[model samples]
Target: MLIGDVSRHSGVSTRMLRHYDALGLVRPTGRTAGGYREYSPEDIRRIFHVESLRSLGLSLKQIGRALDDPSFTPAALVSDLIRWAEDRLARERELLERLRAIDASAPEGWQGVLRIVELMQGLNSASASRRQQAVLSRPEGVPMSVDVLAGAVLTEPDPHVAGALRWALARAGGDGVAALAAGVRSADVDVRRRAVRAIAEMPEAPDATAALADVLGDPDATVRGHAALALGGRGVTSAVPVLVGMVVEGTGDVEAAEVLGALSRDPGCADRIVTALADELAAHTEDSAVRIRLTQALVELPGTTAADLLRELTHDDDRAVALIASAFVGVLDRRSTEDRDG
Candidate 1:
C-alpha cells in the first residue's frame, strides 16, 4: 500500500506515519517509481502495534525499547505503568478534594480563593509549626469549610497541631460532626483516635453525642476510654460500664474515676454508678491495684451506697487497699460532717 492508502486504510494520519518512519518505529519497506513511500503489510502491522502500546501510556522512547528490544519484558514495564497510573489517579483525587473544599468555602472572588488556598497549603505544610499556624491563622468570623478543618484534625500527627485543629473544629460547632464521625470509622487507628478526641470536645449536641456513643465499642481501648469519659461527662449512663472498665484496667483510670464522679451527681445514676464500681470491685478482688483504684474512684461518688462501699473496702483483705479505703472513709466522714454542720 502507498502512504496515502495506508493512512486511509489504517486510520494512522500521514504526518504521524511519516514521523513513525523517521523514528524507525514503522518504516515503509517499498517505494513506487516516483520514489514515494510505500508501506508493506508488515509495516502497516507495526504501525498498529505502536498505536496499541501507546494506548497503555507508554512514552515514545519506552515504546521504541519495547518494540525493538527482545530482552525488554512487558511484565516489569506493565507493573511500572500501573504504579504510575495509580499515582496520577491519587493526585487527581487529592486535587479534586482541594477544589471541593475551596468551593464549599464559597469564596467571593480571587482574593478569597487565594486565602483559602493559602490556608490549605499551611495545613499541609511539612513543618508542624506551619500546620499549627494554618489552623490558628484562619480569620475569625469568616466561615471555613468544616470539612477542611475536620480533614486536618483527622490526619494531624503533631499533638499541638491536633489540639489547635480540634479547637477550631469545636468552634465550628456541629458543622464538622459528620466529617469527624466518618473519621471515627476510619480503619486507621490513629485517625480513629484523632476523630474521637475531636468529637469528644464538641458540644453535647445529639449528633456529637451520637457519634461518641457509636464509637463506644471501638477496638482501641484508648478510643473507647475517651469516648466513654466524654459521654459520661454528658450524663450518658451508657458510659458507666466502660468507665468502670477503665478503672479496672488502669487505663486513664484517674480521669475515668473523675468522670464517673460527675456522672454520679444525677440522682438516678448514683446507685448505678456505685453498683457498677462495686461489681468491678467484686470481679477484680484478686488484683490489689485494681481494688485500690476502684476504692479511690468510690470516693468521688456521693450518697450512702458509695459511702457504704467505701466503708466495706476499709476491711479489704489487701492491706494497701484497706489503708487507702480507710483514708477515703475518713475523708468522706469529714465531708458528711461538714455537710451536716453547713
Candidate 2:
C-alpha cells in the first residue's frame, strides 16, 4: 500500500509514518513506479504494533526496543509504566485537593489565596513548631475553614500544636464535630485519643457528646480517660462510672477526682458519686492502693459526704490508708469548724 493508503487504513498520520521511517522504527520495504514511498503488508502490520505499544504509555524509544530486542519483555517495562502513571495520578489528585481547598476558602485575591495555601502547608508541616506558628499566626480578616483546622487537630502529634489546632477548630466551628468524631473512631490508639481530646473542645454539644459517649468504653485506657474527663468536665453524670473507674485505677485519678467532686455538687449526682466511689473501695477492699485513691477522691465531695467517707476510712486496716484518711478528716474538721465560727 502507498503511504496515503497506509495512513488512512492504520490511522497513523503520513507525517508520523515518514518520521517513523526516518527513525528506522517502521520502514516500507517497497516503492511505487512513481518513486513515492510504498509500504509492504509486513510494514503496515509493524505500524499497528508501534501504535499499540504507544497506547501503553511507552515512549517511542522504548517501543523501538520492545519491537526489536528479543530479550525485552513487556512485564518489567509495563510495571514501570504503571508506577509512573500512579505517581502522576497521585500528584494530580493532590493538586486537585489544594485547588479545592483554595476555592473553598473563597480567597478574595492572590494574597488571600497565598495565605490559605501557606496555612494548609503549615498544617502539614513536619516541624511541630511550624504547625504551631501556622495556627497561632492565623491572620485576622481571613476566614479559615473549620475542616482544615479539624483535620490538623486529628493528626497533630505535638501537644502544643494540637492544643492550638483544637482552639482554632473550636473558633472556626461548623461541622468540625463530624471530623473529630470520625477521628474518635480511628483504630490508632493515639489518633483516637487526640480525636476525643479535640472533640472535647467542640461546642456542638449534642454531637460531640454523642461521639464521646460512643468511645467511653474504649479498651485503650488513655482513650477512655480522655472521653471520661471531657464528659465529666461537661457535668455529664453518665461519666460518673468511668470517672470512678479512673480514680480507682489511678489513671488520671486526680483530674477524675476533681471532676467527680464537681459532679457531686449536684444533690442528685452527689449521692451517685459518693455511692460509686464507696462501692469501688469496698469491692476492692484488699487493694490498699485502690482504697487510697478512692479515699482521696472522696475529698472532692461536699456537704459532709466526703468527710463522712474519710471518717470511716480513718480506722481502716491499711495504716497508710488510715493515716491519709485521718489527715483529710482533720482538714475537713478544721474547715467545718471555721465555717461555723465565721
Candidate 3:
C-alpha cells in the first residue's frame, strides 16, 4: 500500500506518517517509480502500533525508544507513566476544586474573582499566620461562601487559625451549617471535633441545632461535649443530659454548668435540670470529686430547687463536697436576697 492508502486505512494522518518515517518509528518497506513513499503490510502494522502507544500518553521520544530499543523495559517505563498520569489527575482535581470554590463564591466581577483567589491562596499558604490572615482579611463587602470557610475549618490544624476560620464562618452566618454537618460525621476525630466547634459558633438555626443534636452521641467526649454546650445555649432541652454528664465527669464542667443555668431560666426546665443534677449526686455518692463538680454545677441552675439541693448537699459525708455546697448555698442566698430587694 502507498503512504496515502496507509494513512486512509490506519487513521494516521499523512503528515504524521511522514514524521514517523523521519523518526524511523515507521518507514516504508520500498518506494514507487515516482519516488513517493510506499508501505508494505508489515510497515502498516508498525504504524498502527505507534498510534496505539501514543494513546497511552507516550511522548514521541518515548514511543521511539519503546518500539526500537531492545534494552527498553516496560516495567519501569509503565510505572513512570502511571506516576505521571496520577500526578496529572491530582492536578486536575485540585484545579477543579479551586474552580468550584470560585464558582460558589459567585464573584460579581474580575476583582471579586481575584479576591477569592487571593483568599484561597492565603488559606492554603504554608504559613499558619498567612492562612489566618487570609480568613481574617477577606474584603469587607465580599463575603466568603460557607463551603470555602467550612473546608478550611475542617482541615485547619492550627488552633489559632482554626479559631479565625470558625469566626469567619460564624460571621458569614449559619449557611455553613450544612457543610460543617458533613464534617461532624467524618471518620477523622480531629475533623469531627473541629466541625462541632465551628458549628458551635454559628448562630442558632434549626439546621445548626440539628447538627449539634446529631453529634450528641459521638464517641469522642470532646466532640459530644462541644455539641452539647452549643445545643444548651440554643435552649434545646435535649442537651440537658449531655450537659449534666459533662458536669459529673468534670470535663468542661464549668461551661456546662453555666449553660445548664442558662437553660434553667425556663421554669419547666429548671426542675428537670435540678433533678438531673440530684440524680447524678445520688448515683455518685462514693465519688467525692464527682459529687463536688455536680454540686458546683447545681449553683448555676435558677429557682430555689438547685439552691435547695445545694443546702442539702452541705450535710453530705464528703468534707470537700460539703464545704463547696456550703459556700455555694451562701452565694445563692445572697442572689435571692438581691433579687427580693430589687
Candidate 4:
C-alpha cells in the first residue's frame, strides 16, 4: 500500500509513518520500482504491536531493544510489570509503618490513636484482616487480641484498610453495626473520623445517614469535615440542606466549603450552593478563598442565576478572586461573541 493508504488504514498521519521509519521502529516491507515507500500487511501488524507497547509506558528506545531481542517473552514482560507494582506496594507499606511508630510514641491524641489503627491494618493481609473484622462483628467470645486488633484496624490510616473493616461490619449483620457504632463514639477523634469514612463507602442501611449526620456535630472539626466529605461521597442528597447549613453556619471550617463545592456539581444542589455563597460572602468580607471557590462552583452549574453571579464576582474586592472570576466571564463572553459571529 502507498504511504497515504497506510496512514488512512492505521489512523496515524503520513508524517509519523516516515518518523517511525527513520527511527527504524516500523520499516515498510519493500520499496516500489519508482522509489516510493510501500508497506505490506505484516508492516501494519508490527505498527499495531509497537503502539500497544508504547501504551504500556515503554519508551521508543526500550521498545526498539525489546523488538530487537528475540529472547523477550510475553510472560517475562508481564513478570517485570508485576515486580514493579510489588515494589511500589512495599514502599507504601514502609511509609505506613514509620507513620505508625511515630503515632505510637506520641502523646495520646486523635492523630496518634488513628495512626496505630492504620498501622495494624496495613500489616495484616486481606484474609487475616477479614478474620479480625469477623471477630469485631461478633464482639462476644472473641479473643482479647482479636478485639484489640479490630479496634486498632478501625483507626488504620489507610482508607482501604478502614474500608475492609466497614465491609466486615456490614457482613456481621446487627452485631457488627453495634460495634461500628461504638467505633464512631470512641473518644479518639481519628477512630470516629475513620468510622464515618468507612461507613460512607459501604451500602447505606437503616440509620446510616442519621448516624453520619450526627458526626457532623462532633466536637472535633476534623470529624465534622470527614463526615461531610463522606456524605458527599455516598451521594446522600438528603444531606444537602444540612451541608448548606454547615457552609453558612460553620465559619472557620474549610471542610464545609469543600462539601458545598462538591454538592454544587449536582444540579439539584446548585441553588443551595448559590444561596450559601451569597450568605457567606455577605457575612465574611475577608474570606477571599471562599468567594473564589464559590464563584467557581457556581459557574459549573447551568442557569442564568449562576452566570449572573459569576459576572458580579468578576469585580470582587479581592484581586485574586476577581481575576479567576473575570477569566470565567471572559470565556463565556468569547463563546457568546463567537456564537453570534458564526
Clashes of each: 0, 0, 0, 4
Which residue pairs show collisions in model 1? none
Question: Per-prediction TM-score, please?
Answer: 0.92, 0.88, 0.92, 0.47
- Model 2 regions lying over 4 Å from their true place: 1-19, 34-41, 204-206
Off by over 4 Å in 1: 33-36, 204-206
Name the lDDT of candidate 4: 0.66
Could you tell me which 10 consecutive residues in candidate 2 have the lowest summed lDDT? Answer: 173-182
Residue-level lDDT tens digits of model 2 in 57-164: 999999999999999998999899999999999999878878877776677889888887889888777898999999989877567766667777777778899899
TM-score of 1: 0.92
The TM-score that candidate 3 achieves is 0.92
lDDT agreement with native, every candidate: 0.88, 0.86, 0.88, 0.66
**How does model 2 score by TM-score?**
0.88
Candidate RMSDs in Å, in order, are 2.1, 2.7, 2.1, 25.6
lDDT of 2 at 125: 78
Q: For candidate 2, what is the lDDT?
A: 0.86
